[model samples]
Target: MKEFNALVVDPVGLHARPATVAVNAASKFKSEIKLSYKGRSVNMKSIMGVMSLGIPTQSEITISAEGEDAEAAVQTIEEVLKTQKVIA
Candidate 1:
């Protein structure tokens, strides 16, 4: 598995827009990607799963992927999160 932690910087936290962006990004990968916040973890490709976390600003989130494209998946998600200003 490949993973990285990021601090959410968005004032609204991981809301619909950014969550959709993340889900869209994760869906492009074949690997199993997950986003973790607090003690909960959910599939990164699932919009409902991601939004259920209710992640807030300054919260630390861990994104992980397992399978052939694990590294690439994590990297892509990191880039997406950064570009969306969801994490810095």
Candidate 2:
């Protein structure tokens, strides 16, 4: 598994918009993507799962992936999070 910590850069936090972006990006890969904040973890490919985390702005979260494409999935997601200004 590969993991990285990202800080929510969006003012609105991990709400529907950025969470949808993450789900869309994560669904394209075969890896199992997990996002964790505080003490809870959720499937990154599920919009509801992500938004339910209630991640607020400036909060830190960890994104991890496991499976054949774990590296690609983690890297792409990290980049997407930064590029999309959802996380930094």
Top-scoring candidate (lDDT)? 1
Candidate 2, run of 10 with poorest lDDT: 13-22
Error of 2 at 45 (Å): 0.7
lDDT for 43 (candidate 2): 92
Deviation in Å, model 1, residue 8 alpha carbon:
0.2
* TM values, all candidates: 0.98, 0.94
Q: Write the per-residue lDDT of candidate 1 for residues 1-88, one digit (tens) a residue.
A: 9999999999999899988998999999999999999889999999999999999998999999999999999999999999999999
RMSD of each: 0.5, 0.8
Off by over 4 Å in 2: none
- In angstroms, give how far residue 33 of model 1 lies from its true place: 0.4
